[model samples]
Target: MIDFLPMTREDMVERGWDQLDFLFISGDAYVDHPSFGPAIICRLLEKYGHKVGIIAQPDWRSTSDFKQLGKPRLGVLVSAGNLDSMLNKYTAAKKYRSTDNYSPGGQAGLRPERATLVYCNRIREVWKDVPLIIGGIEASLRRFAHYDYWSDSVRRSILIDSRADLLIYGMGEKQIKDLSTQLSTGMCIRNIRDIPGTCYRTESLEHLWDYIEIPSYQNVAKNKQEFANAFKIQYLEQDPIRGKTIVQNHGEQYVVQNPPAMPLTTGEMDEIYDLPYQRTYHPVYEAAGGVPAIQEVKFSIVSHRGCYGSCSFCALYAHQGRIIQSRSKESILREAGQLVKLPDFKGYIHDVGGPTANFRQPACEQQANRGTCRGKQCLFPSACKNLNTNHSEYLELLRAVRQIPGIKKVFVRSGLRYDYLLAAGDREFLRELCEHHVSGQLKVAPEHVSQKVTQLMGKAGKETYLKFKKAYEQTNRDLGKEQYLVPYFMSSHPGAGLKEAVELAEFLRDTGYHPEQVQDFIPTPGSLSTCMYYTGINPLTNEKVYVAKTPHDKQLQRALLQYRNPKNYDLVYEALIKTGRRDLIGYEQHCLIRPPQTKQLSSRQPRPEKTDKPGKQRRLTPTRNKTAKKQAR
Candidate 1:
């Protein structure tokens, strides 16, 4: 009993013949996106009668839309680091290559039918033998054996390059309902690799754990990679999990790991934001008769979930758990009364909240480990009370989602830590959470304005975003109204060098917020700002701080924190007059110049080994108005 979705296309043409059924496929491109983790596995497989279909955001170059959503059906759910790979060439031929299709929103392009896992291997070359299975967060952070900031390369083991027959990974509806009751009482998919959040396809390295009851590998022989380093591993192709050798019993340590991931239930997240959605846009022009209502509006809820603000370039405190966990203000006013009965129902509500919806519990209510923070900031010097700083129950869950019904405005539009709500004194519940969940602009990250780069980037204190930008501008001029606060800014993190990215581009040019879209740090894989951007000194602050950790010094300190044109000032004055960094050459062509890039080195010629062969990876381009120096003729 665990699914709750599939609105029409004939409710998947009447259970499209249950045979070998279970097709969830989400590679996370936020499809018609409702998610309480895909509506409790599509309403618990139609409440136990079994027959599901939710291929959301999957145009993995058509396997006839997974053969019209059913048939010879049984396995294929994929998550664990959910899809994004098509090396360069924006939408090469196109099927799915978006990561905000290259704007200032975190790079990810490749789609010459390169949709996640090459559009699931062209739908397994036309369903050759079915059973794909991958699981979310881009297949649980690339499933194992990592290091690949857009092909900086170490790769292997996303169950061996998406040739996936299995790999369920964390927080999936109890191992996708026990692999659909062991493939409906028959179980192929290789005798279902001992189920549980499965990882499958065995033989030479067999070992399965029947779901870890502890002790299979000869009892903790030197704590198996420190107990496989806190189970946050991710891979879709990096391998090495098979027999990296360890087999013990009796004190318990069979140690191969990869199973225990359940998590979900606020009534399956209010039946996934109260199901029945219709948010479209060019869904072939709302199937003719038009109603694109600027991308078929409405439907975007989440009242809350994990995130106690671990934020050292977040992985959501090791994948969702810093604990804020909400939902209940009449279950978010019954999902805003089913998102105002669609028909592109945009009376506006885009966000309900989570991660920072004014954190409600855990910076103090005890969930200890209190270890690991090797510097990407937060050496913890404020915001205490168990770090779950309150929001007076998110201001009564945003005043019962602004008294629902035909809702015309509920917007909290996520993110507003502003130094843990001024260390949880709650400044009158952050001024009634921005005069009742702001809309005309509120975003807020203040990622860095320098208090030693906001404590090396864990955040809070740079005068706590100017005391919540002066009590959110005197409560929007004492409610005469007119919002605006936006402010996110991140520029070259990991103890931001180049003198703290030019004192954070002169503190976003004295707060007028110019060229302000800046993030450029990308450490990724379970970030602590990728261990201070691969070791520049923060092994627990033996502090030698200074890291722009290369990519041409993180694109010249994120182009001088969003520097303005003048041909990015002759490529930041020939890469800062060849790294002598001549004080950012009078702040380059002004209007907040960038200046860094001057290399002409030929010290009489001998350059070759720039990087080739082995895992073969140069890839990542996206530099746009290239500072040119071309050579591969």
Candidate 2:
């Protein structure tokens, strides 16, 4: 019978286990789904015949909660859930988010900031000598001494702060398996530091070879140029095949990172997804309305992992790597069959995609043998001549999934790399996507339209997006469908200024597309864009970049995206004037917003005469009342 791993002392008793081999502490609620990273790791460990138990969202205030699972026989694993704790708890504005979907009932404040550090410290207090290991998105991205957006400073590697015995980075199935074997064989954690995809602290680097050392923490923290230089080295050497060990010094101790683990083979990927997963949050959370985060992935299938689309603002390069690892169609179909048997089956399979939905194989044949090219991207600026842009395999997989029994419709909700899709020149896939898959609307990310901004973001420019838009519209017309394209746009990236913001607003105006939501770039750890944000220079190209650092400056850039919204009128108007583009504020058909003079005149003439009847006053229209409310504010 498939059941959740032991979560409490009672659960341990029920399993007839006196001790767990590893105790997994997570900041997220106990979710047994494969989509959750903690679940995957824990379930994989259990599959290896090691007993594992979880302590999810433990009270970090004291050692009381940390001691609930007693102490593990071998080690304790810690993770800050699926997301970095700081990013999950706070918004780009550095304010507390009202809700955390990973928590029960969507409550906030269940986990502390820098949750990995806090949880590790608590574990130390409870079991001073227990081996401690940290992994997950929070630990993986912040493994090196890098910039922290929340603190607005360069902080030391999480290994140093959390005092973790070891740090595992990336999708760490391989690393965990190797580490567990060594530990089970009676090897000390400190001496077993040569495993790939793991980072460890050392007093000296005497034993390490074929490694390159970047600038020390002291130098990078004080000098921006040194910081950029260090990041450039780290970014280039992230591949598994060609990458070398990277070491950085922090005072007397040094942090050494082993080369990344090889990407999972198709058979390995199938084994991982085929693990017996309960596929939902633990029953303990049912009373609290369960975890809100699971709803998005409960029915959706993850067909693959990794992406070749190296967008600068994304950290996938560091975490998932550039190599594309996919599951076999047979594996995916089996998962779909399981979903169809669920009691909540609604006939609709929410999604059947991954990081970039249509990417089902490596970018090119050589990537499998030689890894990705360093300091180069497969899809950016332009698709490389060697890039394989075929969609036949992915198209066939989607077709096979749709033919699954009891499956009515399978939507592709994940963002598709439109540039890659177009490069494939597969009109059949496009036609089939429009004819069968899309759920009335398909969302794509063209991040920005300005040529300079798009280049900085490592995304396609306006011309490419426009071409795709035309093709999509024509395809829909051919299918006699009224499908729409919802394009996602970002604001206030490292190189974007008021000028680029206004250019984007103009594009939106011309297309008659008013986006309901605008994404403001957040410079999270481990991304090249974050390096640019902290140091006013692109690490890869040492060129000076414009950064909108102040709150008001960022506000103006975001406002320009939704210029039609009356609430953003003031900031949009200010941005237009600041950029010397006041011409866009007129009453012309091409104008984005009306002149302040016109707006003022209209608001002032909105009051009507009082009614003669007692207690009867004329009600104002929503537009007039909204204007009045803005004026009062």
Candidate 3:
């Protein structure tokens, strides 16, 4: 019978199982959605005929709560929910968040500060000898020695801290399954260290055949340059086929990381998604209010996994890898068809994409055979020469989904790789996107407009975004649609000084697009940008780069994005003066903000003329044109 995994002892008995083979512990409340990692791993184990039970958000203060489901015969699996615990509970400024959408009733502080380590520690206290395996975004990203933004120190690999017998680094499907099978067959955890996409602690390298040893934990911690060098080596070895066995020394022992798992074939993705998932939180949480994280994804579909658009600020490369694995059209359609039958079906599919919405296949044909090139990116600094930029397959998939009987709309809310879209020879996809998928607004991340900053971000330069902007506007005009491109921007990233922040302010002013919300650069672990933030040097080139670390400097950079807001007037003024662009503070027609004033300023800021109307170009009065000509002379 298809049912939710056993969450309690009664549940275990209800399943007619004497004991579970695995007891999966997580920080977030039990959610069976595919987007949830614990759910996917547990369900995959169940599919393999192993009985699994879930212990969601157990009390970390004591081990009593962990005893609810009882111990497992094979091992105990742990994860820090969907997000990193520290990242989920705190902000970039090191402030606690009051709400956690992943929790039941959307409550905060249900889980401890460092969830992965806490959960693993608690599991050890209860069942000392059971195999402890940790996976998920938190564990995956922290699989190696890296910088911790919150603590402001170089921490050892999570494998060493959590004391998990085995750490599955990437998407864990292949690794966990293989590891579980071995454990069930009576193989010890220490003997199963050679599995790809996993990490383990070893006393000596004698057991390892071929491996690349990174700088020891002490060395990376003592010297910033060594830290950067170690990060560079780890970054280069993430590919599934080309990646090597990366090892790092912790004091007396070593932590060894196996190469990433290969991307799942389309049939594999189909089988995983087709599992018997309840697609909602356990009924016990219904009174407290179900999980708030399911709202956006309940009716949506994950079209693919992995991203080639390797934004430096993102952790997809560290967690999902760079390979793009898409589900077949039949599988996506099947999921859409199922969504239509849901009691709350609203005739709208919230999204139909993954890491990148439009990316359906590998960036090039050779990636499947040779794996992605470790050093070179497919679409950064400019699209690579070997990149195969195409959108026909994705366009066709959208068309097929739209034709499903009860589906009224299919929106691509996931971030779209605008540079990749622009590079494609087919404008038909753009036309189709503008015509159907968009629901009055399409959001894309431009991050920054300055070439230096964008390059540091590992994103395409502003020229590419501008080209895409022009094309998007033209497409909207041709389709007679009034949709708006709500571009997302980030501030205070490494390499973004006052100069770069002011450049972004000017772009916002010139475009007449005032973002209601702007993201400040957050240095999450396992990203190249985080390396720069911690070391003040680009690991790729070993060149010194400016990072805005002070609270005041970060505030100024953020204000520059919203320069028109009166609340940010002082910060914006300070940034303008600091950048030596004080001329923009006046009351001129093109000025970003007016000079300081005691009285309250109007909330409505002057916008670019062309932006006020659809399909209209900015026009200057004859007198104003003459004034401009005289000024030029």
Candidate 4:
């Protein structure tokens, strides 16, 4: 019988345990699903014969909650849930988000801002000297001194601020297991610093060998150039196979980061995902309507991990790495079988992919031994000659899952790399995807259509997206399905000024696309785009880039994307005027918006006489009575 990991002391007592080997502190509600990182790590630790318990979204206001589980015999693991705490609590506009999906009842403010630091500080007040470790997205990306958008200043590495003994960076299955083994052997947490995929602070450099030292914290904090240079080195050396040890000085102490943990093999990936995950939030959250985040992944399956898409704004390159690690077909099928047996299976498999769904294998054969090619992207600018754009294995897995009994439809809701799909020259996958997987609409992230913007975003050119769009529409038509393509667009990304935003608006106008939601680029820590947003220079190329920094500037760019929305008329009008593109504000068919004077004039026009006969109604001219035309429709 599979059950959630012990959350309260009574849970441990029920299992005939008086103490825990490790107590995990999370910034999210207890959801023991594979999609949640804390659950995976806790379950893996349990499998290793070490007693583990979790305290999810503990009250950081006092040490009483931190003391509920008492101190673990080994250490305490801290994570800011699946997402960065700040990102989860705030939107791009730095406004407080109304709800947190990871929290029970979809309520917000359960977790404090800078949650890892806050939780760790509370733990210190309670236990004083308990082994403290921090990981997950928050600590992983902030393993070095970098910019913090919220504070609008450079903050030190999370290790230094949180005062953690060790910081585990990537997908931490290997690092956590290794750290557990060493600790089980009675090694002190401070001495267990040689593990890969982990970071530690040290005052002495004598013990460290074969490492590249980037700019110091003081240097990066004050100098934008040094900041970009440091990020450049970190970005290039993120691979597991060929990456070297990276060290950065923070005043008197130094933070050293080991090469990332190797990508999981097929069997290893299987074992991790196959672990006894209850596949939902704990029963304690039942009263609060359960953790809202579980709805998306409850009936879904993760077929792979990691991505090589290398979108500048994406943090997958820094966290999951560029190498792709996919589970075997049998493993995915087994999970799908479990989903079928679920009490609320609903006969639909929501998703069967990860980070970038279509990426099942590495970009090239050389990645097996050499790691991802440094300073080069597989799908940016254009598909590399060495790229492996195969979809046979993934297509086969999808087909197999669909064959499972009790399954009605298996959809690929995760992101699809259309460029890779088109490059493969395989129409069969597209046809099958259109005929079966699409659930009325398929979402793709084109981000932007302007050549300058797309180039800066490290996405494929506009031509590629146009080709894919054409192919997708045609495939759906041939399948006799009316499925639509929902393309996601971003605004105010670095290099996107009024000129570029207008270009994107024109593209949307031309394509007859009115996106309901527009993503305004947020400069989160550790992504290449964040570096660009901060330094006004592309870290990779050291070229100056335009950044829409002011709140008004960002609003204008965002409004331009949704120009058709009546709520955005003022911003759109101002943007068009500012860009000297007032030509776009006229009543032309290609215009993004109608001029204010024209709208006023049309509103002032008299209403036409009511017609009793359907075909005998007077037709309104194109120029006059625009309001009457709207009312007639």
Candidate 5:
């Protein structure tokens, strides 16, 4: 009864169940860890007294593997693993990736491309009529019509294409419990369409009330302007309290997305994380090199959920929402105590943070009751007047965890919003962070230095990051700690042209920090930045913005970030010339590059008068010549 949920028919029979209530199909191998969505959901369902089975990474070429676990009594739950299948199989450049960390042995090509659609289709072929519910990152992000980066075209909701009966978006613990509870009572999936945090297709809108209708999918698909217009409406309605249900016409039927579910209270979050997860991949995978994804998160603890950072390119706001929900300090400490008891527990606790590490409370007290303001962010344009900027609770939580015996250090590896930290006005937190949490280096995301580009990215001004940097350095100096700050940067973001790219390079040079890892803006589905990338206009304002789409241009922008690398010299030189910044290519100390050495110039005599002029040479004579020769030698 304590083992992993039935993966084989024999295991199901051993559990004395003739049929399961839900059969969970996932693109990832079975890892009964809380970090994996499928595991958390399945464990929660089992905790609620429903029987469940898992069919992980089933063969998609045929239905034979899909039918191995037999049909569920109520429904079939489908997911494309923990990550979007498209992102898992392809890089940002749209090239096929060779390995999948979610699979055993870190194998490649275990699941087909677009795993959610393929898995749902396979389930349909097997059952012919079972309720197919798709939930996961892939289904969550694509629950509405959005641009598909791989195909460079607009795609309709995954609910429409996959033919699934229901799509649960966001962190679907609450929604899934409601779904399973209703299914247990014999209510059909179609009739359970009123659940918040869920989406379904309907032919009639008679029962739906208080819903706003977005532009039809056909219209958005045809008109870029209409797509941007529709997206703005969707973005505004993500709040749980004030958000209205959204309906979009797709031909004869409609895709109806209910309002977001309320975030879990502290007690509810504690219960979910405190579940009896095995905390590792299934033992069956030990011979296959175990799950590689768990290695990073196995020792870490997720103390909070959701983020208020609201970076335009990030899908967290759209997927996890802007609400900040956290686990109780007791719950977090209890988990830490358990972590220290594990055989693999090192003195170091790898990380202790969530989407944005320092955000331990709601953006404002009213957010939990009134919901986040539509079309306005808590920390964008400028920090909202109502924003709550404090890190006292978070700082105390970190201190409490580290005080537990057997734990040496706890780092905050997840993103630390520098702007928010600056807004908090707590020098104590900065001092503690530099003194303890930093492991020789701390990573902060400034994204870019240009104001125009940062605005488009939904980040604060460069001055905020600069302020944090000064404070952090001062804290380290006060403590006599020899730690450094590693800032993360991006390239090829919307509204970032050659000019902005060069500006970022100059900023990096001034800071004397060259980032080893750089991210080219990937226009993933279900993000405001993706809307801008596809439409070439700011979706929120309809203002035209520059975008770097071509591979050459994107590479040049990326190269500019690491212009010191010899391998990037060609791309950096090309970017400088193209941006009319040829002055940055000289031998000056501030230059991004030294002028390229030419075959004709490498062997030329050292005469002061010889310039690029084709056939002219002037020489100095007498005492001037002797001084010149001595200088040259």
Candidate 6:
């Protein structure tokens, strides 16, 4: 059972509740996914015997929820993850004719949205002394100094904005555990500086500490306006092992130091993966029916942490680190066994992946360092030099899962690293994958088409994706069955604008798989890419780029990903004409307004399918696979 920290100070007084195990003020509606930060932290707190309550959709517009979720007996955890907030525009841009243009769930701002700080400020209004602990993508991404795209200016550190006592970045399991245990014992917040994975401002106390190394990507010390200029940090947590400044909280006088990044060791990784979890999939659709469990499969198993394919937009590398760490095989399998025994026992496991699912322990274990990562994510722009690209251990792990009694099928639903899949000594392994693994679809994130875009994302060559595609096709044919690589991509990223997005659209249009759902880039405050989005330059490379920042241009840029969706037609047309984006107009109109070639033929001959279906499908294949072949060519 969880409590929603209610609104009103008297109500807090009314509850008259004494000390609590833990207090949780959340940005999410409490969907329990381990990778979904708040849930993991809450569950972990419970594991530590801390009673926790939450404030879902903490409508800053209304302060009622505050009265109920009073100050913590132990401390407070503020996470706006799952259903979290960022620097998304609280107001809508120009409304499209169709309501389909609304920004996805969390991006368009709170229904009566306010910034996290606003929410935190509202809470402090009721209980100012409550120890506030903050983490989650929203907070973590903005933990350091960052450029606020919506405000068109630099912003101060998230600690200043949210008014939290301490900000815990990354996956936060271990760090949070330590924070909770330490605070419960009456350790002052200022004393938490020495703890690993924590960032806090401290009062100068006779410099009572050893070399307190700060991180290179540590929170930027800038005022709100100058803050936007602070968007250079990349990995939110330690992706490898590195750091920046150790300021004395009393005065500005501080020791600016960067520690060698500490990567997660294999044993530490195991503790994370082995945490108890309920993997049963709760279908959102089924809840409406009162049937309880949805028809979808739930494969509740834990994961070893760390992912190396650090996509610029992803926060996993920051939280989990890039090094692969796993719990004992017995521990993972044990969880698998528990899921199989659930009421609607299934013979399959839905997924067993993280970051880039198949990535395993560092390829070469002989390196001087085992885990070396700074919270600034590395998996996004590139694999770490110390990354274990080897898939042998992973293959064995998957193989072992299949041997579980009830697991008739164990699929790799997590997207695969296609580039890594194509490496030498790995093709045979990949070939073996198609032969043995794979349920129906193997998700792959060839995030974009343009080499320029892929380069920006630290992805492998377009050739790598193409080779994987060809090999996959070849493998499927050899196995004599049809399977697919469901590719995942994003729209409106920092490096993408109308031309790039359209080029991607054209690629998709030619390939015949125009995505209907696309991710509009949300310039989360702390991401390196967010810095580039606001500053028009890659901080890492210090290179300038043309950014699509206006509302109208952003809409068109986002719409390009789903050019075939009828709902996007109106907006795309307006976007194209206004932005001088004629190149994308034809495809936009053709897909959204005009009928397809098949539709034209069908109109002429109602029964053409009986006689011309074969040829027609052949004609469609080129267009369908054209995007697919772009890399091959």
Q: Count backbone overlaps in model 6.
A: 58
Residue 458 CA error for candidate 2 (Å)? 0.7
lDDT of 2 by residue, 199-275 (tens): 99999988989899999999999999999999999999999999999999999999999999999999999999999
Tell me the tens digit of each residue's lDDT in model 1 across 146-222: 44455544344455666777766545656777777878787887666655444554444445433323322222223
Backbone clashes for every candidate come to: 76, 0, 0, 0, 0, 58
Candidate 2, residue 350: the lDDT equals 89
- Candidate 2: misplaced stretches above 4 Å? 600-633
Q: lDDT of candidate 6?
A: 0.57
Q: For residues 1-633, could you state the per-residue lDDT of candidate 4 as single tens digits?
A: 127788888888889889999999999998989999998999999999999999989888888888888789999999999999999999998999999999999999999999999999999988878899999999999999989999999999999999999999988999999999999999999999889899998998898788899999999999999999999999999999999999999998999999999998989999999999888889998999998999999998998889999999999998999999989999999999998988988999999999999999989999999999989999987899999988998899999999999999999999999999999999999999998899988889999988888898999877888999899888977878877787899999999999999998888767767666789999999999999999999999999999999999999999998776677778989999999997887656677777685554333322222321111224457765665456434
- Candidate 4 ranges beyond 4 A from true positions: 600-633
Model 5, span 1-633: residue lDDT tens: 348888988888898889888999999999888889999999999999999999889989999888888888989999998888888999878888988999999998999888999998888878888999999999999988889998898999999999999999999999998998898898988899878999999999999788999988899999999999999889988888999999999998899999998898999999999998888898888999998999988989998989988899989887788898899999999999988998988888888989999888999998877999878888888888888898999999999999999999988888988888887888889888887898887888889999999999998878888888888888888999877777788999999998999999999777766666688888989999999999988877889988999999999999999776677778888999888998887645587876675212212222212121211234445776466445444
TM-score list, all predictions: 0.31, 0.95, 0.95, 0.95, 0.94, 0.74
Off by over 4 Å in 6: 1-19, 31-36, 46-64, 67-71, 87-115, 203-240, 246-297, 300-302, 363-387, 497-506, 509-512, 555-633
Of 2 and 5, the candidate ahead on lDDT is 2
What is the lDDT for 461 in model 6? 59
TM-score, cand. 2 vs. native: 0.95
Tell me the whole-model lDDT of each prediction, alpha carbons only: 0.52, 0.90, 0.87, 0.89, 0.87, 0.57
Global lDDT for candidate 2? 0.90
lDDT tens digits, residue span 325-386, model 3: 98999999999998998898989998999989988998899998899997898887778888
Alpha carbon lDDT of residue 77, candidate 6?
76
Whole-model lDDT, candidate 3? 0.87
Locate the minimum summed-lDDT window of 10 residues in model 1: 235-244
